[model samples]
Target: MFYLAFFYPVYLGIFPNTFLNNHIIVIGIYGPLALFTTIIVFGVGFPILRSAYISLRDHRLTVDVLISLSAIVTYGYSITSLAFLGRQFLFFDVATTIIVIAIVSNQIRAKYKRRAVRELTGRLRNAETTVYRLTDEGETETIAAEECEEGDLFLVRPGEHIPLDGTIVDGQGTVNEALITGEARPQRKRPGDDVIGGSVAIDGAFEIQVGENATSTLDQLRDLVWNLQADQTNAERLTNRVISAYTVFVCGLAVVTFAAWLALGETGDSAFLTALTVLIIACPVSLSLVTPLAIGRGLSTAADRGIPILDQTVLERITDADTIVFDKTGTLTTGEMHVADVETSEAADEVLQRAAAVESRSSHPIAAAIRAHVTEPTQSTDFERHRYGVTATIDRETTAVGSPALLDELEWDCPPSIEESILHIRERGDLPTVVGWNGEATGVIALSDTPRKRWEDVVESLSAENRRIVMITGDDPRVAQQFEDHPAIDEVFADISPEGKEEIIQDLKKKGTVAMVGDGTNDAPALTAADLGVAMVSGSDFTVTVADALVTTDDLLPFVDLFEIARKTRRRLVENLTLAFLTPIIGLPLAAIGAVTPIVAAILMSAGTILVLANSYRPIMSQDSA
Candidate 1:
């Protein structure tokens, strides 16, 4: 539309009509002029008038007052200019050019903003599984979240989204609700248990009767995120208010410029042209757009890498986090246990066979590891179940491996050597399991696991950047100490329960930014209390929802990259803001002095916008390549 509108006149200018009396040419002249005039009137007058009306309605108009007065004065001079009407070619062309520039810049700004919105929204919308509703007639139907309605009954299988916030009407299961609570631990939800939408069921099945419609559930969350982002921050709000006030000042200046020319008896054309240049050059579009554009692109780049940044405030907080807190079990180390060592008194093969046989009935990772270690044939027995750990008769001796209290209750006697080994393993911060004969110690096994691969490097890198790393865990102090002595660690806390973690985060908040990284129920409070909270992607839905940031990949290295990305983003934002703020300061005086022609001001404005956009892309493209 813009291209056609702009080129038709050029075509006419170059090809002077061959037929003076031709009906087509006569109609085209009237049609084009009318269309152009209507567009200018609506585009220029409506916005200025509407803005004035809104300002009046709201009882505030420092900027709108200026714009309204400028538009009225310019329009009046434009109408009365004898030369402007006599030389319609130059007059219409100039006016059209200014209007076109304003319209086109606005369109470009909208396009970029939408592009940013699309990128971030896509990351937030990644859902792995869907809930299927079973109708009353015993038929299963899969429905998108938007199609779900209140009071609808939905069935969530072992691996499925909860679909909406509701209570379990008749079934029970353990749900990974990290999205809501930031708790990595799977919560066992029975009948009447409240479930939130987007939470995954890690284990067990649930039949949830939906209470809230999809719009009220997921859509509401999406809206909350959008509103939080759209609502300007303190700095942005102040900047906009100042910009608005500046715009009003410019309008007043335009009025003064026009009145001064009029008093000097200058032609209406000259006065109008000067005032128009002032108004166009003074538009705050570039200044108003600086922060949003830079931050928007930064978020888009991060989202492209599959990192879900739930809260935008985390970006700044994370970059400045001097002290990093990590929960030992799931945040740093792999939550899964592994078989580290095995020991026994009898032949190694016989001891392995006995241990595997006894452990086959257990679901613990250690038990699974023992079962994987040995291959042998043994008589299957219905292990006599006890209140403590399960018991079984092996040959003539009963054996069991469980809590120390369980073993003590069974009155199982073990050798001093085995007892000493257990103490040794515990002192070294290894999780240990014991195996013994009916009344005598026979063997003991030890397992040790630490932070994820490259985790130490991540900590070292942060420290190299002058960040202090701290390890916080619910495990015994011995376990926490194991990581504290690690070269990267600056502090350590052990046996710190959920409440303790929250308290530590609160204490840290008194000084500066605090970030808690974890993946369990115990970590939820700390995650919420900290300045910024990060959780593993695989953690419970409750945990993820409460967490400000989430590291989806198992590798911790990406988080380091995230910190770099954030810092780079902040740098770009600063650059954009500086450019935006400086352009008008430099250009407005030139426009007033008539040193900057209207065309020149428009060109400068466009150049400023392009520079702002180009600057926003710099950090993103660099990080992508790096």
Candidate 2:
């Protein structure tokens, strides 16, 4: 349709006589075909191409408007030429219009594809990993993540993207799984614990026996993120509607103009030329460009900040978002267990030794922390493994301690002093786990993960901007309220199941758009349900795959940056839409009175299109600007 519109003038120039003589009869005879052609090309083909092009580019550009304008120009020329001619002219004009439209749309698609390739290449380069390998001198060596393979042992230093999925074979340390699960806590990893790829080792050194190769791990994650980002809802329907309506309206107006001219006693060529001019000038191609250019620029700016915007349409949704729901464990607090309190009947050193011995066999996070804090004692053949826990005789007593469930069968009772200590530890805001010997309580250890440093500030900033911050977590309510002193949080729902999170999102959606921020496998459903799901780079693949946006940094500062970028982008889109919506309404009246010639109308419309694009391309300010 765009090509036909642009080629209309050329057709009129070549076959001016035929159009003037036959336009009235032609419309009566071929009205259905012309209208059908317009619907198929402009209504369907243009939108399909435009959407596919935008998806491929991962960015919007100005050329979309040019394609639209060219269509209108062709139609305008065809009609104007016929309005002043006789008969004996036809095919050449239609052919030229078709050629121009096809060429311009093809060019736009090709350029966008090339640019997308470059961007993907750059991200692959920057998102690499480094692993340490054993050297001849019992030292270690560093290599790319992809170079490491299954069953190979590698050492992880603090602040590293775990190159592969693996279990720790030796040593102890705290690993930040925020990138994998969006948990802010640094989890303890001891021997036998499973560590995921792309997680940051926050504090500790570990020798890992690799379980999965880097390609299988992170590539799967990237694919998941891409899939989640591509899901669409209703926001994109507006652009589709505009494209559909514009095409039909332009074609109808052209046919009407042609008939009106012939009824005024104009020659067949003159009427055809006038009608074609209307078609070419009124294609609404420029109008189609307004929304995409705005969205594309916004997405590009977000990418620069390490935030992966999966669904570009979410940029518009952000403007209306009033409430932001956050998944607590990984999203708010760092989701790893830490040693909050220690209790013992033996000397601290001796107690640490015994606890480490038991914990070394457990893969739970609490066990990992305990193992890291204690000094390992080499006691040759000191214990015989019992089915419940482990046992070693101290004097005549069989000293044994393990899980609460296992110990309960022994009917072990805590002495008054030990019982008091356990209560004290639990009162200090930590979960207490009892260690026993024979049939008596030996000690109690308490553990809990702390919140991230920037948590309060992030919440406050969003609240100041009139954004409501709510927490949804599977954690106990008592643990979730530890940060309640921070005034930024408006509500909390603790111990929520995945289904519950989705239900909460549905309820929130009734008020307006809501953004769900989370970092765990359990958070995926809610992430998918919300208007926008923001996955912390430190979160899990499940969460990232379901999230609409990906924040690569663990820092909370980028969340603000992400919101601001979306806000500005939506602003630009609205501006473009306003210009597009108002232009033809004003321009058509002037053109009808002969106040604007076809060439002048073409230039004027193109100017508005250019302004919309140029405005959309406004540069994003530095993160410091936020």
Q: lDDT: which candidate is best? A: 1
Instruction: Write down the worst ten-residue block by lDDT for model 1.
Output: 82-91
The clash count for each model shown is 23, 58
Per-residue alpha-carbon lDDT of candidate 2 for residues 381-441, written as tens digits (9 for 90 to 100): 2344333444455445555545333355567777777767756654565655567666887
Q: What is the lDDT of candidate 1?
A: 0.63
Report the lDDT tens digits of candidate 1 across residue range 287-405: 65677666666666665554556666666668778878888876688766666766666665665566666654443345556666766624323344333344556786776654333
Query: How much does candidate 2 score in TM-score?
Result: 0.61
Every model's TM-score: 0.68, 0.61
TM-score between model 1 and native:
0.68
Q: C-alpha displacement of 115 in model 2, angstroms?
A: 7.9
